[model samples]
Target: MVEPVDPLQRLPFGARGPLLDHLSRLRHDLGKYVSLQVRWLGASPPPEALRQAMMADLLETHRGPGGGIDAPTVWAGLRPALVGEVPLDDTITVDLSGDVDFERLDDAMARISGVVRDLRGGVDGPQTVATGIEAARTVSDACRALWSRLRGG
Candidate 1:
């Protein structure tokens, strides 16, 4: 029987740290907002469970057998979280009437798409830095969207 290789091991040395760090931060940022949304809806947030699920999905989607980051797969995993509607109760007094900043979200998605493309081709120092910056920006944009939805702005 052949041993399965760890896909993460295949990433370039310079790229691996930044990419992993980006993923970790992204998960943290999103999880924070998710918890906030749940609370806003008068429900308790399942912090650990949500974090674990998000991390697992991200790892499965990005860490392929060939060691290449799949942009589509990453997008697929993110789309639900990015565009999902929070279940609000009519009896709840929280304002839940606002348009999401789709433009910002789209830009963030585009940035991530570019990062995935660069990773697949092979990341150098500059590319790694750029990807990290973009990943942070993406997280910011997502948070903004969530806030907008919650505020009805």
Candidate 2:
């Protein structure tokens, strides 16, 4: 059996404009929140009052060149604050080649499997509940195994 060809691929050059537009809008909206979060994280170390004051200034005032906070101040805090923005904007893809250490993922998978097993075992009082628990446990096992293999075991 032949799979149907994707019609979208047959459209005029890169005709995914609408889809791209929608995604762009979504990214922009998400960027606003990310920007706010970045600002918040930068100010996190300061006392609350100082943070609030800086936040008000940053939000409300437009600074002339060399006018507001000194260059060193913004350079120090802003760099760390914007740490995850490139990934957030979909501009920079994290090269997970060596970064994805699966040790923690393995631990999490073990915990989840143990919890599922425990829950299935705990549902022994009712026959219908026991059946449901078994079904759920089977599904969880399949998914957990698949995920473990996908994440390089």
Highest-scoring model, lDDT: 1
Give the candidate number with the greatest TM-score: 1
Candidate 2 lDDT for residue 123: 31
For candidate 1, write residues 88-124 as lDDT tens digits. Answer: 1222112112223434455555665565455556553
What is the lDDT for 138 in model 2?
36
Error of 2 at 44 (Å): 5.2
- In terms of lDDT, the poorest run of 10 residues in model 2 is 93-102
TM-score per prediction, in order, is 0.36, 0.21
Extract clashing residue pairs from model 2: none
Which ranges of candidate 1 are over 4 A from the true structure?
1-72, 77-100, 151-153
Model 2 lDDT tens row, 21-139: 43233223222221232244453354444333333332322244755432223223322212232332234322111112222322333433343344345532234333322332333
Candidate 2: Cα lDDT at 36: 37
* TM-score, structure 2 vs. true: 0.21
